[model samples]
Target: MTTSPAPAAPAGPDLTDEQWTTLVRARATDPQAVAKAYAARTRPAPLLSQKDTLFLVAADHPARGALRSGPDPMAMADRRSLLARMVTALDNPEVDGVLGTPDVIEELLLLGALEGKVVIGSMNRGGLDGATWTMDDRFTGYDAASIATNGLEGGKMLLRIDDRDAATAGTIEACADAVTELATHGLMAMVEPLPYHREDDGSLTLLKDTPSLARAVTIASGLGTTSAYTWLKMPSCDDPETVFGATTLPCVVLGGVPSPDPAQDLDSWGRALVQATVRGLVVGRALLYPPDGDVASAVEAAAVVLRAAHAGEDAA
Candidate 1:
């Protein structure tokens, strides 16, 4: 049995032909270059930007097999397009950093798109999307040891709690340990804890109501030995105040499922941004695969919202 030569290096609008060739050659020959790049890349300072807020472009969705965006189920299936869009978003200086798994981060590092940008590695990708035990969300990606050794600024974990799923217990325990471990390294532990309801059909639905979100917030806030280095990555809810009131931990609003109407999505983020505890925005598909397919515009629009929120607070 013979394997066909690997398909031609993927191409994208912003992925120059030279860069594509470089990636191809690097993967085929210089695998160690990734570590070399990590060691040489310039790290960010103060973590958050001048406004004291994080503005990260999330690229960890693909790790869990969630490649849907808008009407396209496999919108993020193309590595070239995904990395190109991420590079476009990060090119805008206002965008502070990125949250991704090791593969995505390494690719971006090789692409030279992360210099001077804070990098947060995603943990807990074992619970693949659509798997029966997806709620487990086990730690299968970056561990604290690797994160520290790789010079990453932090680690992010997903904690989806379902009352009927026994796996949730183990997941919670794992996240707690991760939180403690990340903090022990003096690194940020960004925990995204969401309430999930399991239906009789075995499907899980996120509970976004005020009470549900508040409960989830409280649970995540109490994880690990200390909350000093813990931050929350949450979705914007109808009642931002009530939901955010549950904890004092600094929170960053995540752009969940994208809507065709970008205005509606930005509006929701604006509301959450004004909340005292909400500090930033970590978005992915909403900006990467916008309806218009303009990644830069989507990223700029989000940066504007972030700036406006902090400006409003200063004016107040």
Candidate 2:
């Protein structure tokens, strides 16, 4: 949003002059173009491109006030730079799809970056970053109906449980209702259940330990009337086997905090992908704003890891 000098974002896939003009024009005039674009866009079939695995780029963070990537506090504050990196990631042939909120997705739709890609709408982003009531991640984005009506393959909701917070209960309930609603439309309900512990000082921390993660997985696995159309979006951890052993639902590992070592991060994902239920990666900043500022290269590396994991699975 700012025009000031900020940290460099990933390079290439920059928007053309025409592309920028088209989006600006649409925003100023043609409001109905978004719906028309969705109706006419080619949809993906069989969802999973690699039979069992997928690799999806994610850009829904900005909506939730999560604009930081690495050391830069406002690294994702510039819409053009952020969207350009997203375009770069989606340009990779091996990338299966993308996950985003309405505004970002609408822009990409107008830019023609989402056609034939698996589009997942982010549902809850009401919990602002560092807010006191952050645990109340109310549904403020795409609801189940809107996601289906817009032709998205699924809807995603973030469920962070801080045991001490009462608001966590409402978030859990809302996510359950959303899962049921999405199931009625034959759409995927991708629930990201994260365990958090509110410190005495009021700071929150993600509990990525094996037991904490496994507990969160089981709790998410039972939402709604049925688990038939549900999938878990979980974080990868050491001893992934034990961490993910509690769920039979298909799972995808999300790229959480960006690490300085890309190869080390890939190795962590590769280990998680070994689990039969772990299908693929749904990564954002770790790929979009890599340390080297190469979006395509980061995406390609993720794809390679995904392919290798499935190949190893088949061989075994």
Best by TM-score: 2
Reference-based TM-score of each model = 0.95, 0.96
Clashes of each: 0, 1
State the local distance difference test value for candidate 2: 0.90
In Å, residue 299's CA in model 1 sits off its true spot by 0.7
Clashes of 2: 1
The C-alpha lDDT values of all candidates are 0.91, 0.90
lDDT (10s digit) by residue, model 2, range 1-316 = 8777655544545677888888989988999998898898888886788557778889999998998998778888878888888888988988888999999999999889987899999999999987887788999999999988989999999999999999899999999999999999999999999999888999999998988999999999999999999999999899799877898999999999889899989999999998989998999999988998888888999988888889966776
Give the clashing residue pairs of candidate 1, or none. none
Candidate 1 per-residue lDDT, tens place, 27-78, comes to 8899999989989989997898878889999999999998877777777888
Best model number under lDDT: 1
Local error of candidate 2 at residue 229 (angstroms): 0.4
